[model samples]
Target: MHYDVFNGDADGILALLQLRLAEPKETALITGVKRDISLVKQVDVGQATSVTVLDVSMEKNTGALSELLANDIPVFYVDHHRTGDIPESPLLTSLVNTSPDVCTSLLVNDYLKGKHHLWAIAAAYGDNLKKVAARHCVLNGVGSQLSTQLEALGTYVNYNGYGRTTDDLHYHPADLYQKLLAYEHPENLFSNKSSLFYDLESAYEQDMNMAQTAEVLFDNNICKVVCLDDAPWSRRVSGVFGNELANQSPDKAHGVLTRNLDHSYTVSVRAPLNNKQGADEVCIRFPTGGGRAGAAGINALPEEQIETFISVLQNYYD
Candidate 1:
């Protein structure tokens, strides 16, 4: 049996989307809410013929990945995050680039020789690689109007992936991936009136409206922190809201912390747009935290350490 494992976020979903479109395959899809990144171990290697992993950090999944490689499971791994130390095995094919300007889908696009360039652009935008996405369009001769639409598609699809669990999402990531595979091109998704695009777009607007009222925990020239109440909307909008704040400020690092059920916090950190290098560093300092340099997050943070987190963010960015 072939198993396709990926992060639920746009980069992971779209990366796999491009590959499946280019090389049609029948496989079981494994995914969860955006924070659920330790997916490699969840796959039952007993019934697996091959495995494909995308967008998830290898650092966190190293143990499971090593086991799969030891068993000769034949894994194709692709990502744009901190990879601890990739195993050296003939059965393993790794395409990981930790470059701040790229996303997993962009790397997949290169692998496919641009078979799905438009979809790749959307993933780039979703990852908040806005400058790179724009430059990609300019380099490829794509017009401005189409670029804007791709941005919206990326944002909406990306917005759907955030949540405490799949229950909070408008569409499960697997369902959303299946829904999107129907469209040969990203633009076709926009043309269809009854597409998931419209639903996601509407939902994005609603959650973002709620995020506007988040309480500012701290703000300075180096970094800023905003707190959201314990609600579904808070869980659904925390990461994307961080992206929005990063884009708006560009000069200051941003953190969006949503209260969790245990009085802990779910945190999303975006390094300054002008200097996207410290997010992963800052987040990895906390337990249950890991991500790429441009944007990283803590799945759960203690309420007591909230102040410490803020101090770390400022210190890292300063």
Candidate 2:
């Protein structure tokens, strides 16, 4: 059977959604929390069929991907994250762009020739491509009211993807994908009051409320760092909270750290909204860290390095 591997975040889910909506497929789905990007290895290579991988970094999955190519299994890979060095093989079809302005969903939208751009716009908003999503909305003649709805929907879907594990998430990414598959377009889900949007909106609001009380570890002219204690809510909100902070203070780089059980931390970093670059550079310096220019994260950071993280961010932004 075919395998569909993707990041659980909004960009990955929506990218595959758009592709399947355009060309229906029956495949085994493999995904996990947003930070769980090394997914290509999960595919049952013995099953023997084509594979479609989305959103997750090519660099992290390079080994598994290389094996797939060696097996002569055709693979369609699309993403906007850092891809170290692409392997050479005619069996691989890769559309990897590291541009901060784009996300996997937007790439799929381009591939589909805008057949399902509304979903793409929402995905863009969820991926924090505010300007790009807004431009797409305007181009489609979507008014302010609809644009706001799309943005909220996108953000909520994205928020549901974060968590230390699926137990902390409202819906497993696979379930969430199935729920969204019912809608041919986002507008349908928006009009249906019973859609997952309402549940996610309420949960997102509660999580953000708790995040508001999280202690600020550091603040300065060029950077701000906040740390949340070990809790399910902290794990769920850390990434989105950083996005909100970046929007609130466009000139300051932001970091949100959620203390893990071992006292290590899961970190999310956002470059200044006014200057959407270098976040990946800052995060890549740490172990278990990698992402795009505008946004990046570290899966686990030793507690002792917290000060170093703050200093690196400050020095980079300063």
TM-scores for every candidate against the unseen true structure? 0.99, 0.99
Each model's lDDT comes to 0.91, 0.92
* Model 1: per-residue Cα lDDT over 1-318, one tens digit each: 999999999998999999999999999999989899999998898998899999998999999999998888999999989998888999999998998988999999999999899999999999989999998999888899999999999898888899888999888999999988988898887788888888888888998999899999999888889999988888888888999999899999999999899989999999999998979999989988999899999988999999999999999888
Give the clashing residue pairs of candidate 2, or none.
Answer: none
- Model 2: weakest 10-residue lDDT segment is 186-195
**Per-residue alpha-carbon lDDT of candidate 2 for residues 1-318, written as tens digits (9 for 90 to 100):** 999998898998899899999999898999999999989999878895999999999989999999988888999999999899999999989998888899999999999999999889999999999999999998889899889998998898889889999999999999999889989988888888887898899999999999999899999889999999888888888888999999999999999999888889999999998999999999999988899999999999999999999999999989
> Residue 134 of model 2: what lDDT?
100
After superposition, candidate 2 runs with Cα above 4 Å error: none
lDDT of 1 at 231: 85
